[model samples]
Target: MSTFGDLFRVHTYGESHCKSVGCIIDGCPPGLKLTEEDIQVQLSRRRPGQSDLTTARSEFDTVHLQSGTEHNVTLGTPIGLLVHNKDQRPHDYAETDLYPRPSHADYTYLAKYGIKASSGGGRASARETIGRVAAGAIAEKYLKEAAGVEIVAFVASVGKVELPFAQGEDEVLGKEFVELLRTTTREQVDKELTRCPHRETSDKIADAIRSAKSREDSLGGTIICVIRNCPLGLGEPAFDKLEAVLAHAMLSIPSTKAFEIGSGFRGTQFLGSQHNDPFVDGVDARTGQKRLRTSTNWSGGSQGGISNGEDVYFRVGFKPPATISQQQNTAKYDGSTGVLETKGRHDPCVLPRAIPIVETMAALVIMDMFLKQNARSSAASLLEPVDHLPPSMILPGKNKVVETQLVEDKVVQE
Candidate 1:
């Protein structure tokens, strides 16, 4: 249950107050360049104490590569990584001993395991995502080298503050929003402490976070991620669709409340005629030949549960961090009533630090799907072409997936 992925497996371990928190990556392709610093970059982004809006907990989150490398080259074996929890203060969570801490995992974890960690939230803490972020950095390196895939995520909103252009006319498919998805980089996102690329919106989000922090409360918002240059056909049909797996991966993040791809909930209001992504003729950069691409990307680069070689985008909604410093009247483990106030450093708004975590999780999902599709395509390539099927069913020539679409269109016209 602690592990994820099929071809690129990752198993995470440790807890918030544990001695260390890290992961073991199994099935990493061999002979790729890797180092502690490569992984450390993303870890530092996710670490607390980066700004006043985030948790005050001071953690360097320095990563150590324990195994599975030879002189910076992966040995095609399970990679082991570790990051010591140097600044842990277990005594800060002593309040959880009596009360369950409403909206926190204290009560349910005890009900399920019959006992819970005496300090911190244990596996439920955002600290658990450290291992995921580390493993994702490795997968992301391989994907970029092997497929030229680029994944980027940014804080799209904080409470009521959002980028005005994103919600402009024509919905998310507007020219400006599309260009933003296509061009915004991690550096641009990191320009603000809120991780929002829009300067004015970022300032507003920061102020809202400070307001909540001053009140000893927390706020929640959304994150938008884009994956470009994804290979076609990277999902399993009938189940585990590309979007489905993406939803699973995103919802697993602590406090994440919702996941939606492409047009998301906004597209629901559009009729099929308005929402459909019409196929258009385009030139492939690699081959200098005509290719089929969607005129609009409302499908988020996936169609019929498979990638369509277009930019994939999605939004994830995170709930307010459950552990706030404010006092609350709640029930204890024994069902008794009491006033419980949480201790320890906590974030008023997690959107900023959560940026890298979101990008890494997306990288992990894409890496797994890419490997699965690669195997399927490799095996299919060895088979002789089948010519008996109708033109609508059989692609006209090697990689002429558009021919099948044209034939289907003719049938509909008839």
Candidate 2:
């Protein structure tokens, strides 16, 4: 379960308080323009101490490419990415060894392995997500260049405060919102420390998080992520549906408690006649071709477990961070009652930091599924004479996609 994906697989390693943390990404296509700079954009967003809303711990979090690329280009081999731990304070978590924090992974991990790392909840800490964010940035870059795919995630809610645009029904992701959601820049989200796009709600969320930090308590919230311009037919049937895989990715984030895709649970309030997406046929505005679209996207761009060329959107509910620095009644490993006061640098509201993590994870899912779908749909192009090639493979003066196949004109006479 630690490893993910079929084509663009990434295996992460290291613990929270370890000397370093990193991931090895296999199956990345050759000839991609990859560098530490490409990966750092997302890492910087996920970094701790970006603002007062997140944890104050600082590691610089500078990534160093260990392998799989030369001259800043991918080799189609395994890419090794690492970020060394610089400011780990294991002594701060020494007491956690004697008593497992309530609602934290200490007890479950110990039960599974009969032993656990004693510092910063080991691999269970949000620090473990650093590697995930790095790998995701790579996936996102490849997807963007290959298919013009765009991934965006924003803090939808902090406690009871929610962004007006992303709130309401989960299935409300539509053409109207795609443009609006796409308008939400990282700069706008960063304007307020809460990372909620709405200015008013962002302030409320910030105040709530600060209040929790003051009380030594924690707050939980939700994030809404969207995948734009995803190609059609990327998903497996039955168990591996696109929506199902998306749910799997979101729920995998630390402290995530629930997952919903398009219309989600709220759609149940409507009848079948109201919830169904009616097909609308039209001419393409860009390609000048015929196109079929759903008038409404209650299916969230997925139907029968596969994408239908619409924007895929969903929401993930994150629970309160389990590592609150407050005294609570809890049991020790010896099965005795004790007052446990967890200590360490932790985020009061995990939703803000979870945004980049969510974006990267979504990129991983889309990148993997797109590769799988491309294999099946690229057959007609094979063995055909190429008029144009990918920018990396094309000669000078060729940048557009070549669709005009070579045709032989020979007249036969009897």
Candidate 3:
């Protein structure tokens, strides 16, 4: 489906070669001081031709707020957005009519719909993500204002070139990685063309991408995203688990092939004792109140399908882009074999520009989950006090003083 979310609905429209690409963001709270520039910040990052390492397709991707805003403020209605495609060359993809490019969506889309877009990979193109990025920016703004939530993503690896922290044993959750998650910002990420924070590693990744581009080939990589200060109890149990929904969202991206949260595959090597996150006494920064926290985040800030108020982090793996300029012998729609040469601009490695898309998609998932939890908590607040219940069902320090009184009252009533 083109639409995503329950409370915060986002319906994306248009395609790669379409006149415009954008989204309609429904359920945004009113009075959010939104403007085209606010959304442009992210769109610019995801746009093509940012550097030689990316696609050569030149596009400013200038966005226009079509509706759902007045005087630069959201009206609590469905926010409509649009970004015109100025550099489109549908003729560049004319060869696709003969051959269904290998590893591409050409065959599947046609098989499912009986017809596919004739140019630029159509909805399968990265251009489709422009709408997601726009909508995510809005959700992120609301999250930042309401909960002080911060979301940051960085390229973790490119064709075996990985950050030192990710390469070391037990370092996936080490102090250095945790600190990076705590302090890394978009400015730091954009400092390098590869979007990898480490200078030396970023340079190595650049070389790897350049090597692939020289051969008309492509490289695959991974991205790590961290969501700081995410509210607790944001997951839906029995079905839409936090990590499960996150996987669904991340994997929906164009090239994303794998998704993992916290210890991920590495946890498989450890015994239960080593992987379990131990509860520890801590203080809430916002309220300076006592709270329970985990000594380790092997659960990725989610346990029992609910956020634990810890920094939530995950990694998404992207396959080498299926579209390359190289020639290949493959079967066409008619089951005929021939040499097919692909044309058009495409990233040899998508990790860099994909950073914002990853961050924004995470924002969308978090925003939707936050709203679901908010509604549940709001409804629960109106109910009678737990002063009528047992201490076992109540939080450690909350409503403790009423336990004895409630027990005595129960005995008298009996």
Candidate 4:
């Protein structure tokens, strides 16, 4: 099942190079302002052929609302979104029948199903992420308006060229850090078609990609994401940890190799004292009210499978895309030795376009958790007025008042 979430469920369907691929979102609350334009914003970001570095497959990837929506609003029913395949060149893959492309799923898919789709990579293609992104955009709106949560992701590293981080002692990446990184990354992407903004480094990576393309090989890299203002008590402990859910979402994407959340592998280099986030009581700069907070966020805003009112950050690693144009040693299904060359258009590096997908998955997880928190708190209804009162009103303070009860005697006895 290509579905995620227990409360706000999203089920993705269809395959790459197919007639269409889409997602069905169940449990979307009614009366929320939703429109096809909202979904298209994120889709356009992930769509291929938008730039020179990406694949040349020009797909409009437009979203068509098939059901569960009217007048641009959700009807409390399952919302369906579809993206039709417009530019499929099936003839390019004719040779794949004889020699399955090395490093691709062609062989494994055949071994498992005893048959496979000849065009594109079938379900294994990155094209499937379009549905995830579309669903994510909607999820993002819900999370932001309902829970005051925000998610932002960018290409943090391309091969060896990494985006420079803001100078700070805090282990967690905050909104300022993310904004700075985004600015630098966008500038780089604009200057260089490869999406690596640092001129010298971008050139080097471009050279490597061009070299790999010439040799018929592919390259891989990593993306870092940050989520901020997530409310506390979102995820379930033990069985459904926040990190576990995020990992599941990321690994579902094609070519994803690894997933790591705050301090991740790097924390191993530090002592326990250095890695632990120290709890403190302080006045929030934005709200000017005392609240329970952490001076450092080495734990990535999650404690005991629930958010702790801090930033949540993670990194996803992708293996080099498998559809290298290079010819490689392989064999036919009948065991005849032959040379294999992959057909069809593919990105030498998939990190830039993958940015939106990462953001989308984060939105899905955050939105689902938000909905689950609401469902748990209110038994009668999931929709309720969001409490956006000042922190002092909700938190303990010197001026806080306590309710007192007076004892009264009843004349009538049992």
What's the count of clashing pairs in each model shown? 0, 2, 0, 2
- Per-residue error for 386 in candidate 1, Å, reads 2.9
Candidate 2: regions farther than 4 A off: 165-182, 283-289, 380-414
Model 2, span 1-414: residue lDDT tens: 679899999999999989999899999999999989999999888888878888889877899999999999999999999999998899988888789888989999999999999888888888788888999999999888877778878888888877654344544434444454657767777676788887777789989999999998889998878787776678889999998998888888889999988768766777788789898985433234456778777777899998877778888999999888889998999999999887778888888888999999999999899777665534433544555456556423323232111110111111
What TM-score goes with each of the models?
0.94, 0.88, 0.94, 0.84
Candidate 1 wrong stretches, greater than 4 Å: 165-173, 285-289, 399-414
* Candidate 1 per-residue lDDT over residues 1-414, each given as its tens digit: 899999999999999999999999998999899999999999999999999999999999999999999999999999999999999999999988888888888888998999988888999999999999999999899888877788999898899988663455446456666777889999999888899997888889999999999999999999999998777677888789999999999999999999999989888877888889898888543334467888888999999888888888999999999999888988877788889889889999889999999999999998998777666555555566565566666443454222222122212221
Over all chains combined, what TM-score does candidate 2 have? Answer: 0.88
Which residue runs does candidate 4 get wrong by more than 4 Å?
Answer: 164-207, 283-289, 380-414
Worst 10 residues of 2 by lDDT: 405-414
Error of 4 at 195 (Å): 5.1
Model 2 residue pairs with clashes: 170-263, 171-263
Per-residue accuracy of model 4 over 1-414 as CA lDDT, tens digit each: 778887788888887778899999998889889888988988987889876567888888999988888888889999999999989888888888788777778889898998998878788888878878988999988776665566766565666666554345544444554454334433344456555555665677677767766666678888777787666666778878898899999999888999988767866666788778888986543334466788668788798987777778888998888777777788987899988776778887887788779988999888887776655544322334335656555334312121100000111111
Which whole-number lDDT from 0 to 100 does residue 295 have in model 4?
69
Clashing pairs in 4: 188-197, 216-326
Question: What lDDT score goes with residue 307 in model 1?
Answer: 81
